[model samples]
Target chain A: MSGEASKAIEPKVLWGGGRSPFSISYGKIMMWIFLVSDALTFGGLLVGLGFARHAAVTKGFAWPSSEQVFTHFPFTHEHLPLLYVAFMTFILIISSVTMVLAVEAGHRMDKKKVAFWLALTVVGGAIFLGSQVWEWSTFIAGPDGDITTWADNATLKQNFFLPISTEGGHAILGMEGPQAYAMFFFFITGFHGFHVFTGVVFNFIILMNVLAGTYEKRGHYEMVEKVGLYWHFIDLVWVFVFTFYYLV
Target chain B: MERDDIIEYSLHSHHSAEEGVKLRKKIYFVTALLSVITIIEVLVGVFISRSANEGTGLWEAIKMGYIVLTLIKAGYIVLVFMHLGDERKYFKWMILVPYILFLLYLIFIALNEAIAVGEGMKL
Candidate 1:
């Protein structure tokens, strides 16, 4: 093969104003920029979450354990703490792996392999969405036992002495304003989850295109690379969410 | 470097296609190591919670430790798994430094507000 012909086989460098030789597609570069902005948005939300938590602390409001509020599963009376969320985390990680595989296939110009991996990524993403729905349902359900909505003037002593379940499988009284915290949790996490849901659908469309040999005929899989960036960004966001919302 | 030169260099450095296989294995190893650290963190958090129900100063310290460890894990994910470390230095700074600064600002404001509110309750 001539030097030019051999060079044509190499992947094209996309953006970066010729400052770097890093060979990423233009679509992928744009996706990274988008992800940076999106990351900022999530960071703001998390900061807001932290602020709310701090405010509750300052107001003499005792915060409920995440284990207590996130307890309970749909279609069953038994309480399963953290299991649903753990399952969701696993699903998202698996989907991320599939996405990486798809990107790898694209590198080799294997359209069929790319399509198969993308399909798997889409399925993993759908399972993650379903898991999120289950998690949200459990979150909205509140505690397993009798729940009381306290008045604003309810004394700290009374509020703190109120019985609440801990993640340790024991009940302790004294936490306060769990409902308020729950509202923030639902809103912030639900927003992130919605983003993931949209990403999955978008990825599925790309998968279909690959299967139809559209990208193969076009001589590039930049679209797959672009969606891969988005998919990875979602995974990145989840890492933070899992830490702050659950573990922390 | 020219496109052909880059490819030729990469292939030459590898000495064979097996290098790609070796690189993939390294990636998996790193990923597994990170996952293990995460599991350890969860276990530590659970253990700390069990013994420190009263929210003592010691429990607070443990919570801080948990938060720090979580940040470390996140940093690893971004730097290693996301290939941010392999990118140009400018890109790395562009993505990471701003995030760190913003996160610190949020933390500072949150703690300050919380402290202010706590003091107000005592009045």
Candidate 2:
């Protein structure tokens, strides 16, 4: 075929056989595709949760503010605020940083360095998963003591959510709409936590592969880079969950 | 056997201990930035909402502030941790623009629904 006619007949970047289009490997591109779709799933959950939150507030329900509801601390028995969850977020992000570092090391073909960073990433993910477990237990256990509920207006008169008991402890005097609030909170955060749980398991396998010199033999730690993408995606997801579920 | 030219070694600077150090520094900086943002958000939530009436402008502003800060953090994570910024502009926009547009549309519909739900409760 003539050059002009051949060019005219050929499709551009998207349809070009084996063309990466973005210089990313097919594997990385596929991972990106999956991540983008996963991101939409998270977006849908947050949007649905947002709608429920609005409905609860507008329907004259006393939607629990995340600040108060998640004030749970571990030992102090006093409201530790979002301290623990913030730490969890920090840990997740730090793990992400390590994952990226591992990928960078892999690019350099430094198997030892890759293993070092990947090991740290695994530790970070483990700690984050552990924090999730603690948070979930506290959430499921409910506030320590008796519980009282009032409508939104009645909330003004009784502000004590966790009344300190002279004997053991007073019940949580939450506003009336907590059941609905708890439902959304539990569902969305639970799903995110499940992802974190799976991510840690996934990272552990990658870590084992690294230790086994799998990537070293392959001449590059591209596997670490691919898993790093997933790790960072989890961390990115948590940023939204923290924003939508806790902050906003 | 023919060599695949596409599988060449990474063209970035050869591994230097300095590069490792620089990477560590960047990670620490990102961690610090994230921590600061989280602290400010927590402080805003605790102080403003606790002190002001929930319906007040200050409280509302703080709530809005949290969302904006969150978007900023999300953008930062995508750019840095996900290395999306390293991508070619075309690829970056192709992946990101649609998601942004979709999320904005979803937010718009959701807020409208919320307002409607609230209004209906007045009946």
Candidate 3:
């Protein structure tokens, strides 16, 4: 009876039926789909921004130059334009490099190295978020002059406004107010910053896991690899933001 | 299972591990190239803007050029760094084709809407 039980037949089962062509590893495939959805949202925001600018132009409101609008530092009277934004871009790029190194270390199962790289990535991300806060504050402060001038080829008109004078005496030209740009700025960048913040927090958790020897117990750092995917996606989004918002 | 099979498997493992290192180096080299191109694009944009003020045809062309360079950078990042280039062909099309089509649709709708809004504001 024991020999018969040991040699008992197994039931037949079908394998690999109805598999998805879109499938990679679970984490990677999900990231791709998430990116696709996120791209749509960003496209909508950019298109809306374009529409707003066009409307302003048609209404004889002058578009503020990118250089002019983003020209202030926290607690400083000196105005700087592309320099600060370029610094922010550099910070984000360095963070991306740190993320890549973390993933590399994870592949080798070097928990200590992964933790170090992830820590650096988090610090870089925090610096970027701080810079973004400063940028937004500068943007919302608005221009200085009470009267903004509007001009086309044919005519020049002066529009009077309350002297909501801030620091520099540059006139706030075009539109009813800076509220439109300010709102969009906060919304789009805030959204992106939130993602960066989450990525940092996620990296921190993985770092903790590495420190706790959980990954060692599991004998693999697949979790670290997955989190790296999220980190890289955040960096990719920022590249697009820098291109469209600042450079273009 | 056989002695030769074990030897072959060991050799394959050694070869693939070396290949992986080479692949990573290639990816790094491409990333550096992309960074250089990005700097070039930014410099060109600055020079073009300085030479031709806003609303000039050259300024418009520069703007278009900036967009093109950005797309190129994006393509390289996805293809090389993200390993999309090494992915299965069907998977690549499944992800990219829809994205391009949707982006084009978005551009069309956005431009039309912008024009309409511009016209309305003019009126």
Best model number under TM-score: 2
lDDT of 1 by residue, A37-132 (tens): 888889888877777677666666666666544445666876555556666766776677677667655655678878898999999998888877
Q: Name the better of 2 and 3 by TM-score.
A: 2
Name the candidate that leads on lDDT. 2
DockQ of each: 0.23, 0.33, 0.21
TM-score of chain B as predicted in candidate 3 = 0.76
Model 2 DockQ vs. reference: 0.33
lDDT of 2 at A169: 62
- B4-118 per-residue lDDT for model 3 (tens digits): 3121111111123354467558657765766676667655544444223777877777778778877887777676555566555666887799988988888788777766777
Residue A220 lDDT in model 3? 62
Stretches off by above 4 angstroms in model 1 are A1-25, A73-79, A141-176, B1-19, B45-47, B50-54, B121-123
| Candidate order, DockQ descending | 2, 1, 3
After superposition of all CA atoms, the RMSD between model 2 and the true structure is 7.7
Regions of model 3 farther than 4 Å from truth = A1-23, A73-79, A141-178, B1-20, B41-52
Q: Write the per-residue lDDT of candidate 1 for residues B7-98, one digit (tens) a residue.
A: 22112111123543564575576567656756676565455452245468776776677677767766765665455665555557876788
Q: Write the residue-wise lDDT of candidate 2 on B38-110 in tens digits.
A: 7887776665543335778876777778788888888877877776776656668988999999999998999
